[model samples]
Target: MNENLTNAQNIANIVAQEVELMSALVQLLKKEEEVLVDNTPDKLETIVLEKNTLLTQIIALEKNRNSSLSQSGLSPDAEGMNLLFSQLSTSSDVQNNWERLLNLSSAAKENNRTNGILINRHMVRNQTTLNILQQNDQTASVYGADGQSRVNSNSGRGIIAG
Candidate 1:
Protein backbone atom coordinates (compact mmCIF):
# COMPACT_ATOMS: atom_id res chain seq x y z
CA MET A 1 0.00 0.00 0.00
CA ASN A 2 3.10 2.30 0.13
CA GLU A 3 2.70 2.86 -3.53
CA ASN A 4 -0.90 3.90 -3.17
CA LEU A 5 -0.02 6.17 -0.30
CA THR A 6 2.79 7.77 -2.24
CA ASN A 7 0.57 8.20 -5.26
CA ALA A 8 -2.08 9.68 -3.01
CA GLN A 9 0.36 12.23 -1.65
CA ASN A 10 1.39 13.25 -5.11
CA ILE A 11 -2.22 13.49 -6.24
CA ALA A 12 -3.03 15.59 -3.20
CA ASN A 13 -0.22 17.98 -4.01
CA ILE A 14 -1.40 18.29 -7.57
CA VAL A 15 -4.91 19.02 -6.41
CA ALA A 16 -3.67 21.69 -4.05
CA GLN A 17 -1.62 23.38 -6.74
CA GLU A 18 -4.50 23.21 -9.18
CA VAL A 19 -6.77 24.81 -6.61
CA GLU A 20 -4.38 27.68 -6.08
CA LEU A 21 -3.99 28.26 -9.77
CA MET A 22 -7.71 28.23 -10.27
CA SER A 23 -8.21 30.69 -7.44
CA ALA A 24 -5.77 33.18 -8.87
CA LEU A 25 -7.36 32.87 -12.26
CA VAL A 26 -10.79 33.47 -10.71
CA GLN A 27 -9.63 36.75 -9.16
CA LEU A 28 -8.22 37.87 -12.48
CA LEU A 29 -11.44 37.00 -14.22
CA LYS A 30 -13.43 39.07 -11.75
CA LYS A 31 -11.25 42.07 -12.46
CA GLU A 32 -11.72 41.51 -16.15
CA GLU A 33 -15.48 41.45 -15.72
CA GLU A 34 -15.39 44.81 -14.00
CA VAL A 35 -13.33 46.20 -16.83
CA LEU A 36 -15.75 44.77 -19.38
CA VAL A 37 -18.85 46.04 -17.63
CA ASP A 38 -18.76 49.33 -19.51
CA ASN A 39 -17.70 47.73 -22.79
CA THR A 40 -20.00 47.63 -25.78
CA PRO A 41 -22.06 44.52 -26.53
CA ASP A 42 -19.77 43.44 -29.36
CA LYS A 43 -16.72 43.37 -27.12
CA LEU A 44 -18.55 41.24 -24.61
CA GLU A 45 -19.29 38.78 -27.41
CA THR A 46 -15.59 38.19 -27.86
CA ILE A 47 -15.24 37.33 -24.20
CA VAL A 48 -18.12 34.91 -24.44
CA LEU A 49 -16.59 33.17 -27.43
CA GLU A 50 -13.28 32.84 -25.67
CA LYS A 51 -15.00 31.62 -22.58
CA ASN A 52 -16.81 28.93 -24.57
CA THR A 53 -13.56 27.61 -25.95
CA LEU A 54 -12.08 27.47 -22.48
CA LEU A 55 -15.19 25.75 -21.18
CA THR A 56 -14.83 23.02 -23.80
CA GLN A 57 -11.30 22.35 -22.69
CA ILE A 58 -12.15 22.43 -19.01
CA ILE A 59 -14.98 19.97 -19.52
CA ALA A 60 -12.74 17.57 -21.37
CA LEU A 61 -10.12 17.74 -18.64
CA GLU A 62 -12.69 17.18 -15.92
CA LYS A 63 -14.01 14.14 -17.74
CA ASN A 64 -10.53 12.76 -18.07
CA ARG A 65 -9.59 13.46 -14.44
CA ASN A 66 -11.88 10.96 -12.81
CA SER A 67 -10.85 8.35 -15.29
CA SER A 68 -7.24 9.12 -14.60
CA LEU A 69 -7.62 8.70 -10.86
CA SER A 70 -9.36 5.38 -11.20
CA GLN A 71 -6.88 4.16 -13.72
CA SER A 72 -4.00 5.34 -11.58
CA GLY A 73 -4.89 2.28 -9.58
CA LEU A 74 -3.69 0.08 -12.39
CA SER A 75 -0.79 2.18 -13.70
CA PRO A 76 2.71 1.04 -12.82
CA ASP A 77 3.39 2.56 -9.44
CA ALA A 78 6.96 3.74 -10.06
CA GLU A 79 7.23 4.46 -13.78
CA GLY A 80 5.43 4.98 -17.06
CA MET A 81 2.02 6.47 -16.25
CA ASN A 82 3.14 7.75 -12.87
CA LEU A 83 5.97 9.69 -14.46
CA LEU A 84 3.63 10.99 -17.13
CA PHE A 85 1.08 12.16 -14.60
CA SER A 86 3.74 13.36 -12.20
CA GLN A 87 5.29 15.62 -14.78
CA LEU A 88 1.91 16.82 -15.96
CA SER A 89 0.89 17.49 -12.38
CA THR A 90 3.22 20.49 -12.20
CA SER A 91 3.18 21.44 -15.86
CA SER A 92 1.96 24.63 -17.48
CA ASP A 93 -0.76 22.78 -19.33
CA VAL A 94 -2.64 21.95 -16.14
CA GLN A 95 -2.27 25.46 -14.87
CA ASN A 96 -3.50 26.88 -18.13
CA ASN A 97 -6.51 24.60 -18.17
CA TRP A 98 -7.56 25.73 -14.71
CA GLU A 99 -7.01 29.31 -15.67
CA ARG A 100 -9.26 28.90 -18.65
CA LEU A 101 -11.98 27.37 -16.53
CA LEU A 102 -11.92 30.38 -14.26
CA ASN A 103 -12.19 32.73 -17.20
CA LEU A 104 -15.13 30.82 -18.58
CA SER A 105 -16.99 30.90 -15.29
CA SER A 106 -16.52 34.62 -14.85
CA ALA A 107 -17.46 35.36 -18.44
CA ALA A 108 -20.62 33.33 -18.13
CA LYS A 109 -21.59 35.34 -15.07
CA GLU A 110 -20.93 38.60 -16.86
CA ASN A 111 -23.01 37.45 -19.79
CA ASN A 112 -25.91 36.71 -17.50
CA ARG A 113 -25.64 40.16 -15.94
CA THR A 114 -25.58 41.76 -19.39
CA ASN A 115 -28.69 39.84 -20.36
CA GLY A 116 -30.37 41.26 -17.29
CA ILE A 117 -29.42 44.77 -18.32
CA LEU A 118 -30.86 44.21 -21.78
CA ILE A 119 -34.09 42.88 -20.34
CA ASN A 120 -34.47 45.87 -18.06
CA ARG A 121 -33.81 48.22 -20.95
CA HIS A 122 -36.52 46.52 -23.01
CA MET A 123 -39.00 46.61 -20.16
CA VAL A 124 -38.45 50.30 -19.52
CA ARG A 125 -38.71 51.06 -23.23
CA ASN A 126 -41.98 49.13 -23.51
CA GLN A 127 -43.45 50.95 -20.52
CA THR A 128 -42.45 54.32 -21.92
CA THR A 129 -44.02 53.39 -25.25
CA LEU A 130 -47.23 52.38 -23.55
CA ASN A 131 -47.41 55.63 -21.60
CA ILE A 132 -46.76 57.67 -24.72
CA LEU A 133 -49.48 55.82 -26.63
CA GLN A 134 -51.90 56.35 -23.79
CA GLN A 135 -51.17 60.07 -23.71
CA ASN A 136 -51.46 60.36 -27.49
CA ASP A 137 -54.82 58.56 -27.51
CA GLN A 138 -56.08 60.71 -24.64
CA THR A 139 -55.07 63.90 -26.42
CA ALA A 140 -56.75 62.89 -29.69
CA SER A 141 -60.15 62.00 -28.15
CA VAL A 142 -63.62 63.58 -28.43
CA TYR A 143 -63.32 66.06 -25.53
CA GLY A 144 -59.97 67.76 -26.11
CA ALA A 145 -59.38 67.74 -22.36
CA ASP A 146 -61.85 65.17 -20.99
CA GLY A 147 -59.30 62.33 -20.97
CA GLN A 148 -56.36 64.64 -20.56
CA SER A 149 -53.86 62.49 -18.73
CA ARG A 150 -54.47 63.05 -15.03
CA VAL A 151 -51.36 64.52 -13.46
CA ASN A 152 -50.79 62.98 -10.05
CA SER A 153 -53.45 65.05 -8.27
CA ASN A 154 -51.22 64.27 -5.33
CA SER A 155 -47.54 65.20 -5.09
CA GLY A 156 -45.73 62.76 -7.43
CA ARG A 157 -42.45 64.62 -7.87
CA GLY A 158 -40.73 61.93 -5.77
CA ILE A 159 -42.50 62.79 -2.53
CA ILE A 160 -43.37 59.91 -0.25
CA ALA A 161 -47.07 60.18 0.61
CA GLY A 162 -47.17 57.23 2.98
Candidate 2:
Protein backbone atom coordinates (compact mmCIF):
# COMPACT_ATOMS: atom_id res chain seq x y z
CA MET A 1 0.00 0.00 0.00
CA ASN A 2 2.86 2.36 0.79
CA GLU A 3 4.45 1.60 -2.57
CA ASN A 4 1.15 2.26 -4.29
CA LEU A 5 0.82 5.59 -2.59
CA THR A 6 4.33 6.60 -3.62
CA ASN A 7 3.63 5.63 -7.20
CA ALA A 8 0.38 7.59 -7.13
CA GLN A 9 2.16 10.66 -5.83
CA ASN A 10 4.79 10.42 -8.54
CA ILE A 11 2.16 10.10 -11.21
CA ALA A 12 0.28 13.07 -9.80
CA ASN A 13 3.40 15.21 -9.80
CA ILE A 14 4.14 14.30 -13.40
CA VAL A 15 0.57 15.09 -14.42
CA ALA A 16 0.76 18.47 -12.70
CA GLN A 17 3.91 19.35 -14.64
CA GLU A 18 2.30 18.20 -17.85
CA VAL A 19 -0.68 20.42 -17.13
CA GLU A 20 1.52 23.43 -16.57
CA LEU A 21 3.44 22.88 -19.77
CA MET A 22 0.24 22.25 -21.69
CA SER A 23 -1.20 25.50 -20.42
CA ALA A 24 1.85 27.29 -21.73
CA LEU A 25 1.38 25.53 -25.05
CA VAL A 26 -2.20 26.79 -25.22
CA GLN A 27 -1.09 30.34 -24.64
CA LEU A 28 1.64 29.98 -27.23
CA LEU A 29 -0.87 28.75 -29.74
CA LYS A 30 -2.96 31.85 -29.17
CA LYS A 31 0.10 34.02 -29.80
CA GLU A 32 0.80 32.01 -32.92
CA GLU A 33 -2.69 32.75 -34.19
CA GLU A 34 -2.17 36.43 -33.63
CA VAL A 35 1.15 36.37 -35.44
CA LEU A 36 -0.38 34.55 -38.38
CA VAL A 37 -3.26 37.01 -38.58
CA ASP A 38 -0.90 39.97 -38.40
CA ASN A 39 1.42 38.44 -41.05
CA THR A 40 4.46 38.85 -38.86
CA PRO A 41 6.95 36.30 -40.11
CA ASP A 42 9.67 37.34 -37.68
CA LYS A 43 7.48 36.98 -34.64
CA LEU A 44 6.05 33.77 -35.99
CA GLU A 45 9.48 32.20 -36.24
CA THR A 46 10.25 33.03 -32.62
CA ILE A 47 6.88 31.77 -31.49
CA VAL A 48 7.40 28.53 -33.36
CA LEU A 49 10.69 27.98 -31.56
CA GLU A 50 9.10 28.66 -28.22
CA LYS A 51 6.22 26.34 -29.04
CA ASN A 52 8.58 23.55 -30.00
CA THR A 53 10.41 23.88 -26.71
CA LEU A 54 7.22 23.79 -24.69
CA LEU A 55 5.93 20.82 -26.63
CA THR A 56 9.17 18.99 -26.01
CA GLN A 57 8.84 19.57 -22.30
CA ILE A 58 5.24 18.46 -22.28
CA ILE A 59 6.05 15.30 -24.21
CA ALA A 60 8.78 14.44 -21.78
CA LEU A 61 6.44 14.84 -18.87
CA GLU A 62 3.86 12.65 -20.57
CA LYS A 63 6.44 9.95 -21.14
CA ASN A 64 7.49 10.09 -17.52
CA ARG A 65 3.89 9.79 -16.38
CA ASN A 66 3.30 6.85 -18.68
CA SER A 67 6.46 5.16 -17.53
CA SER A 68 5.41 5.51 -13.93
CA LEU A 69 2.05 4.01 -14.78
CA SER A 70 3.71 1.10 -16.55
CA GLN A 71 6.01 0.49 -13.60
CA SER A 72 2.94 0.25 -11.42
CA GLY A 73 1.58 -2.49 -13.75
CA LEU A 74 -0.94 -0.08 -15.24
CA SER A 75 -1.72 0.14 -18.97
CA PRO A 76 -0.77 3.79 -19.36
CA ASP A 77 -4.12 4.76 -20.85
CA ALA A 78 -7.41 6.18 -19.61
CA GLU A 79 -8.34 2.87 -18.08
CA GLY A 80 -5.10 2.73 -16.18
CA MET A 81 -5.49 6.33 -15.04
CA ASN A 82 -8.97 5.56 -13.79
CA LEU A 83 -7.76 2.57 -11.88
CA LEU A 84 -5.01 4.57 -10.26
CA PHE A 85 -7.35 7.40 -9.30
CA SER A 86 -9.90 5.02 -7.87
CA GLN A 87 -7.29 3.55 -5.51
CA LEU A 88 -5.87 6.91 -4.45
CA SER A 89 -6.86 8.77 -1.28
CA THR A 90 -6.54 12.14 -3.02
CA SER A 91 -8.32 11.03 -6.16
CA SER A 92 -10.29 14.20 -6.62
CA ASP A 93 -7.28 16.49 -6.90
CA VAL A 94 -5.45 14.17 -9.25
CA GLN A 95 -8.53 13.55 -11.39
CA ASN A 96 -9.27 17.25 -11.63
CA ASN A 97 -5.68 18.01 -12.69
CA TRP A 98 -5.84 15.31 -15.34
CA GLU A 99 -9.10 16.72 -16.69
CA ARG A 100 -7.65 20.20 -16.85
CA LEU A 101 -4.65 18.87 -18.76
CA LEU A 102 -6.94 17.19 -21.26
CA ASN A 103 -8.93 20.37 -21.79
CA LEU A 104 -5.81 22.44 -22.36
CA SER A 105 -4.47 19.87 -24.77
CA SER A 106 -7.67 20.06 -26.76
CA ALA A 107 -7.48 23.83 -26.95
CA ALA A 108 -3.89 23.65 -28.23
CA LYS A 109 -4.86 21.16 -30.89
CA GLU A 110 -7.69 23.37 -32.17
CA ASN A 111 -5.50 26.44 -32.25
CA ASN A 112 -2.88 24.55 -34.21
CA ARG A 113 -5.52 23.49 -36.70
CA THR A 114 -6.61 27.08 -37.19
CA ASN A 115 -3.03 28.20 -37.71
CA GLY A 116 -2.59 25.46 -40.31
CA ILE A 117 -5.55 26.81 -42.24
CA LEU A 118 -4.13 30.31 -42.14
CA ILE A 119 -0.76 29.06 -43.41
CA ASN A 120 -2.39 27.16 -46.25
CA ARG A 121 -4.35 30.23 -47.29
CA HIS A 122 -1.18 32.30 -47.34
CA MET A 123 0.61 29.66 -49.40
CA VAL A 124 -2.15 29.60 -52.00
CA ARG A 125 -2.13 33.37 -52.30
CA ASN A 126 1.66 33.42 -52.71
CA GLN A 127 1.57 30.69 -55.35
CA THR A 128 -1.08 32.57 -57.31
CA THR A 129 1.01 35.73 -57.26
CA LEU A 130 4.07 33.81 -58.45
CA ASN A 131 2.14 32.26 -61.32
CA ILE A 132 0.91 35.67 -62.44
CA LEU A 133 4.43 37.11 -62.33
CA GLN A 134 5.81 34.16 -64.31
CA GLN A 135 3.13 34.49 -66.97
CA ASN A 136 3.70 38.24 -67.32
CA ASP A 137 7.48 37.69 -67.59
CA GLN A 138 7.06 35.22 -70.44
CA THR A 139 4.78 37.54 -72.41
CA ALA A 140 6.48 40.87 -71.61
CA SER A 141 10.06 39.88 -72.39
CA VAL A 142 11.28 41.73 -75.53
CA TYR A 143 14.86 40.39 -75.65
CA GLY A 144 16.03 36.86 -76.47
CA ALA A 145 19.02 35.01 -74.97
CA ASP A 146 21.41 36.39 -77.66
CA GLY A 147 20.54 40.00 -76.77
CA GLN A 148 18.39 40.33 -79.89
CA SER A 149 14.95 41.91 -79.92
CA ARG A 150 12.13 39.39 -80.42
CA VAL A 151 8.80 40.53 -81.74
CA ASN A 152 5.52 38.80 -81.03
CA SER A 153 3.65 38.10 -84.24
CA ASN A 154 0.36 37.86 -82.27
CA SER A 155 0.75 41.35 -80.76
CA GLY A 156 -0.92 42.95 -83.82
CA ARG A 157 1.26 46.09 -83.48
CA GLY A 158 3.31 46.92 -86.56
CA ILE A 159 6.05 49.51 -87.17
CA ILE A 160 4.50 52.60 -88.72
CA ALA A 161 7.57 54.89 -89.26
CA GLY A 162 10.48 52.41 -89.53
Candidate 3:
Protein backbone atom coordinates (compact mmCIF):
# COMPACT_ATOMS: atom_id res chain seq x y z
CA MET A 1 0.00 0.00 0.00
CA ASN A 2 2.86 2.36 0.82
CA GLU A 3 4.51 1.47 -2.46
CA ASN A 4 1.29 2.19 -4.31
CA LEU A 5 1.03 5.52 -2.49
CA THR A 6 4.58 6.43 -3.47
CA ASN A 7 3.93 5.50 -7.10
CA ALA A 8 0.70 7.48 -7.09
CA GLN A 9 2.55 10.53 -5.72
CA ASN A 10 5.16 10.19 -8.42
CA ILE A 11 2.46 9.88 -11.07
CA ALA A 12 0.66 12.90 -9.69
CA ASN A 13 3.85 14.96 -9.79
CA ILE A 14 4.37 14.00 -13.42
CA VAL A 15 0.78 14.86 -14.28
CA ALA A 16 1.14 18.25 -12.61
CA GLN A 17 4.25 18.92 -14.67
CA GLU A 18 2.46 17.83 -17.82
CA VAL A 19 -0.40 20.16 -17.04
CA GLU A 20 1.99 23.07 -16.59
CA LEU A 21 3.75 22.31 -19.87
CA MET A 22 0.48 22.01 -21.76
CA SER A 23 -0.70 25.27 -20.31
CA ALA A 24 2.55 26.87 -21.44
CA LEU A 25 2.04 25.40 -24.88
CA VAL A 26 -1.44 26.88 -25.04
CA GLN A 27 -0.01 30.26 -24.10
CA LEU A 28 2.64 29.92 -26.80
CA LEU A 29 -0.02 29.07 -29.34
CA LYS A 30 -1.88 32.23 -28.39
CA LYS A 31 1.36 34.19 -28.79
CA GLU A 32 1.85 32.54 -32.16
CA GLU A 33 -1.62 33.65 -33.18
CA GLU A 34 -0.74 37.22 -32.19
CA VAL A 35 2.48 37.00 -34.18
CA LEU A 36 0.59 35.68 -37.17
CA VAL A 37 -2.05 38.37 -36.98
CA ASP A 38 0.50 41.13 -36.51
CA ASN A 39 2.68 39.67 -39.29
CA THR A 40 5.77 39.71 -37.09
CA PRO A 41 8.30 37.18 -38.31
CA ASP A 42 11.16 38.26 -36.06
CA LYS A 43 9.41 37.18 -32.85
CA LEU A 44 8.18 33.90 -34.32
CA GLU A 45 11.47 32.02 -34.14
CA THR A 46 11.71 32.59 -30.41
CA ILE A 47 8.17 31.34 -29.88
CA VAL A 48 8.86 28.25 -31.95
CA LEU A 49 11.99 27.46 -29.94
CA GLU A 50 10.20 27.93 -26.63
CA LYS A 51 7.37 25.69 -27.73
CA ASN A 52 9.83 22.98 -28.75
CA THR A 53 11.48 23.13 -25.35
CA LEU A 54 8.13 22.80 -23.61
CA LEU A 55 7.28 19.79 -25.79
CA THR A 56 10.55 18.13 -24.87
CA GLN A 57 9.86 18.67 -21.18
CA ILE A 58 6.36 17.24 -21.53
CA ILE A 59 7.67 14.16 -23.36
CA ALA A 60 10.23 13.52 -20.65
CA LEU A 61 7.61 13.79 -17.91
CA GLU A 62 5.37 11.36 -19.81
CA LYS A 63 8.23 8.91 -20.06
CA ASN A 64 8.78 9.10 -16.31
CA ARG A 65 5.07 8.59 -15.69
CA ASN A 66 5.03 5.60 -17.99
CA SER A 67 7.98 4.11 -16.15
CA SER A 68 6.20 4.52 -12.84
CA LEU A 69 3.10 2.86 -14.22
CA SER A 70 5.13 -0.02 -15.61
CA GLN A 71 6.79 -0.52 -12.25
CA SER A 72 3.34 -0.87 -10.77
CA GLY A 73 2.55 -3.64 -13.25
CA LEU A 74 0.41 -1.29 -15.34
CA SER A 75 0.52 -1.22 -19.13
CA PRO A 76 1.21 2.55 -19.36
CA ASP A 77 -1.99 3.24 -21.25
CA ALA A 78 -5.32 4.80 -20.35
CA GLU A 79 -6.41 1.47 -18.96
CA GLY A 80 -3.24 1.33 -16.90
CA MET A 81 -3.86 4.79 -15.52
CA ASN A 82 -7.38 3.84 -14.59
CA LEU A 83 -6.16 0.71 -12.88
CA LEU A 84 -3.55 2.62 -10.95
CA PHE A 85 -6.09 5.20 -9.92
CA SER A 86 -8.29 2.44 -8.59
CA GLN A 87 -5.50 0.75 -6.71
CA LEU A 88 -4.14 3.85 -5.03
CA SER A 89 -5.91 4.69 -1.81
CA THR A 90 -4.79 8.32 -1.95
CA SER A 91 -5.68 8.71 -5.60
CA SER A 92 -8.03 11.69 -5.42
CA ASP A 93 -5.21 14.20 -5.81
CA VAL A 94 -3.63 12.17 -8.58
CA GLN A 95 -6.96 11.85 -10.40
CA ASN A 96 -7.56 15.58 -10.15
CA ASN A 97 -4.10 16.31 -11.51
CA TRP A 98 -4.61 13.87 -14.34
CA GLU A 99 -7.93 15.47 -15.24
CA ARG A 100 -6.33 18.90 -15.30
CA LEU A 101 -3.58 17.58 -17.54
CA LEU A 102 -6.16 16.15 -19.92
CA ASN A 103 -8.05 19.42 -20.11
CA LEU A 104 -4.87 21.39 -20.82
CA SER A 105 -3.82 18.87 -23.44
CA SER A 106 -7.17 19.19 -25.18
CA ALA A 107 -6.96 22.97 -25.15
CA ALA A 108 -3.44 22.86 -26.56
CA LYS A 109 -4.58 20.60 -29.39
CA GLU A 110 -7.49 22.85 -30.30
CA ASN A 111 -5.37 26.00 -30.23
CA ASN A 112 -2.68 24.34 -32.33
CA ARG A 113 -5.29 23.36 -34.89
CA THR A 114 -6.59 26.92 -34.97
CA ASN A 115 -3.06 28.22 -35.58
CA GLY A 116 -2.55 25.68 -38.38
CA ILE A 117 -5.69 26.92 -40.10
CA LEU A 118 -4.49 30.50 -39.81
CA ILE A 119 -1.16 29.55 -41.37
CA ASN A 120 -2.89 27.74 -44.23
CA ARG A 121 -5.16 30.71 -44.93
CA HIS A 122 -2.17 33.02 -44.96
CA MET A 123 -0.33 30.65 -47.31
CA VAL A 124 -3.25 30.56 -49.75
CA ARG A 125 -3.63 34.36 -49.74
CA ASN A 126 0.11 34.82 -50.28
CA GLN A 127 0.07 32.24 -53.04
CA THR A 128 -2.70 34.13 -54.81
CA THR A 129 -0.74 37.39 -54.50
CA LEU A 130 2.38 35.67 -55.88
CA ASN A 131 0.43 34.19 -58.76
CA ILE A 132 -0.86 37.64 -59.69
CA LEU A 133 2.65 39.16 -59.56
CA GLN A 134 4.27 36.29 -61.51
CA GLN A 135 1.57 36.42 -64.19
CA ASN A 136 2.33 40.09 -64.82
CA ASP A 137 5.02 40.54 -67.47
CA GLN A 138 7.73 43.11 -66.62
CA THR A 139 7.91 44.15 -70.24
CA ALA A 140 4.22 45.01 -70.17
CA SER A 141 4.73 48.06 -67.95
CA VAL A 142 2.00 50.60 -68.67
CA TYR A 143 2.41 54.38 -68.77
CA GLY A 144 0.09 56.64 -66.80
CA ALA A 145 -1.79 59.62 -68.29
CA ASP A 146 1.05 61.89 -66.94
CA GLY A 147 3.60 59.84 -69.00
CA GLN A 148 5.06 58.26 -65.81
CA SER A 149 5.49 54.47 -65.44
CA ARG A 150 2.35 52.97 -63.87
CA VAL A 151 3.11 50.71 -60.93
CA ASN A 152 1.74 47.14 -61.01
CA SER A 153 -1.15 47.27 -58.51
CA ASN A 154 -0.80 43.52 -57.70
CA SER A 155 2.97 43.40 -57.22
CA GLY A 156 3.74 42.03 -53.73
CA ARG A 157 6.56 39.69 -52.67
CA GLY A 158 8.57 39.54 -49.49
CA ILE A 159 10.86 37.34 -47.42
CA ILE A 160 8.22 34.62 -47.49
CA ALA A 161 7.97 34.84 -51.26
CA GLY A 162 8.01 31.34 -52.73
Candidate 3 worst ten-residue window by lDDT: 138-147
Model 2, stretches more than 4 Å misplaced?
136-162
lDDT per residue as tens, model 3, 13-86: 88888888888898999999989888787998999999999999999999999999988788987888989888
lDDT of each: 0.52, 0.85, 0.83
Worst 10 residues of 1 by lDDT: 74-83
Clashing pairs for model 3 are none
Q: List the residue pairs that clash in candidate 2.
A: none
Please tell me which model should have the higher lDDT, number 2 or number 3: 2
lDDT string, candidate 1, 1-162, tens digits: 555545544544454454544444454455445545544445656556655665555455444444455555644322433454454545455444444545655655675576567657766876677666565576443323444545445565675699
Candidate 3 ranges with C-alpha deviation above 4 Å: 136-162
Distance from true location, Cα of 34 in model 1, Å: 3.1
**lDDT (Cα, tens digit) per residue for candidate 2, span 1-162:** 677678899999998898889988899899988888998878887898998899889888888888888888898888899999878877998999999998998999999999999999999988677555455475665655464655657667776796
